[model samples]
Target: MLSRLRDRPWTTALLIACVAQLLFLWGLGRPGKLSFDEVHYVPAARTLLALAYPANTEHPLVAKAFIAAGIALFGDTPWGWRIFGTLAGTATVLGVFACLQLLFRRTPVSAFGAGLAMLNQTLLIEARTAMLEVYLGAFTTLAIAALLWSMRGRPALRLTLSAVLFGLAVGVKWAAIPYVAGAGLLLIWGKSDQRDYWPGLSLFPALALFGLVSVGTYLATFAPAFFYAQDPLTLSRLIPFQVEMYQRQTQILAPHPYQSSWWSWPLLIRPIWYFYEPDNGVQRGVLLLGNPAIMWGGLVAVAACLWAGWRRRSRALLGVGLLWVGSLAVWAVIPKSLGFYYYYHLSSIWLCLALAAAFHAYAKGRFARANEWFALPVLMLFVYFYPIISAAPLSGPQAFNRWMWLDSWR
Candidate 1:
């Protein structure tokens, strides 16, 4: 049974996703109130359900739409607000597992990577709350996984699916634009060396076709917003609304307590406190810190991937390194004056890929078993930090002091 399961990557991926969903769902309504940006998004979702003029126009509508769906199904409670995010978070874990399987064809390595992703704290907190980042992360990660799966066979269908997923990602957040561009560049690179890479079409035409499909899908997500009974958005106003969104995104905002720069993200310098409050006699908190073992260790692994990929011309390693760098690099150039560690949500999953790739590279070495055991520290740290990250009741107000090893984290 074990051997058969190992041979089937999707089965392993599904199993990992199921476990991740349970973790995400556990104590999901602990705070029993909106946490962090849920204050903004949950209300927007409610307004969306009312079919009123769109709220939260700064972001595209798809994520709020999903949130609205959750509310409609589960009622206007914390569980209803966050259930879909939990599911999306589970989808992200599944996508990470599938991507690793496609890149390395090793079920153990892929499952290990997915496990690290679930324990990566950022995903945990975001998944349990009503937020856009996890939804955006799920769509973009799945799109990348689909692109990789397409490389093996059945290009037309999978590639089209990839485009649609990318579009949905953009509809969740414009942050996906760079990733969409990265996917196109990967396709172009694939065509240069591999025959029939994109089937019959030449480079530019294939790019154009995917681009159109993605844009069309992005526009389609606004269908709900367009039908508002009051101040309904019209086709004529669509492009102008996008321009307004860009301006809103770029305008400098008042400084936030937890904001950090893109360069500081991988270092885990400053993490956002999504929810920190008293519940009865105990203090409950939810911090967006990454698993330190994975965060710092994955950097070394990513460097190893880049060096080995360049030396051996391995597309998988190079793609992992490039996508991680590309995702982080966009934040540096975007006009948003303020940034938060949570913005690194998309790039964090790639660290799982880097670690998996690095482990796969060393599978035959004397320390191969030791490499596999690396997940132990990752899991241990996750448990150690679970109380604060999960909004579990801490012993006292200063209970967070134990976890605040770094001064910057405070």
Candidate 2:
């Protein structure tokens, strides 16, 4: 079996990533309760299904429509609410696998990278919940995947698809605006003007194609809401909703207990409690956090990447630094009054990718085969903290304290 997997590492690795995400997503959310953003998204899904006036007009309909499809297949239960999320999360894991495979054909390294992507605590928590974050994260990551694929030749189709997906991502959440810009800039930077740079594809033509597809698909996502008879704007009036949503975005949010600023996310100091229901007889709490070893070590690795880039003058190291850092940097400058650490999720995925690169770098030594053993500790820590993350009934408050290593985590 081991030999067979070794012979077909890419196939094996992809399966491992997809299946692990499915099991992980499927296992949780069985407690049958909405957590945090599920309330807004799930109900919006039902409203979309009813073809009633759109309830959550601030966000676009594609992701909720996805959840609605799941509910249509499975019934209006917790499992139904989360089925699409599980699927989206699975797609995200597979996207990481494909991206890694595209960058490094080495099976061990690619497989290890995919595993690292799934091991983040915030990812674990968000993967199972019915929320816009997973969809936005998955689509943006896939867009980046497609964008990277285009850079490796065979540019036309992949580049076009990347733009389409980017549009879909934005349609899901306005938060995706920064990612779309980031992806576009990355694509532009890498596009070679030399006629032979990307055979059979012109940079400017591909750039124009990206713009058209992005606008076209984003408008298409609003089709259902546009045709709704009750939306007032109905058929041809998207401008009103767009204007209202823009206005809504500008309004400040009231104080919320779980909110955290952009700077706090990398430190893993403030984990939001999605739920606390001791009064409901089944005592449980769900907390979102990143794995300590990976997150803390990854932060150190970020610094190391900067040093490596400076010392060796390596563009690749510098690019990796730009990716994770740039992903979080958008939130730092955003004008929102309240932001949550979960907002850091899209970047955390890339941060894990950087961490995986570090592990692959360290995999040379016989005793410290980073690729082979790196996932072991991540998985172990995930299991150790599964109780709090999954909102499983704690044995006691003492058990809870063990999980809360930081006072800010309270």
TM-score of each: 0.97, 0.92
Q: List candidate 2 segments past 4 Å from native.
A: 1-7, 193-197, 232-236, 278-281, 309-315, 362-368, 371-373, 396-399
What tens-digit string does per-residue lDDT give for candidate 1 at 212-235? 889999999999978897899999
Q: How many residue pairs clash in each candidate at the backbone level?
A: 0, 0
Looking at model 2, residue 357 earns an lDDT score of: 60
Q: How many backbone clashes does candidate 2 have?
A: 0
The whole-model C-alpha lDDT of candidate 2 against the native structure comes to 0.76
**Best candidate, TM-score-wise?**
1
| Model 1 TM-score relative to the real fold | 0.97
| Model 1 stretches astray by more than 4 angstroms | 194-196
Residue 130 accuracy (lDDT) in model 1: 92
Q: Candidate 1 — worst ten consecutive residues by lDDT sum?
A: 193-202
Cα misplacement distance, residue 206 of candidate 2 (Å): 1.2
Provide the lDDT at 2 for model 1.
76
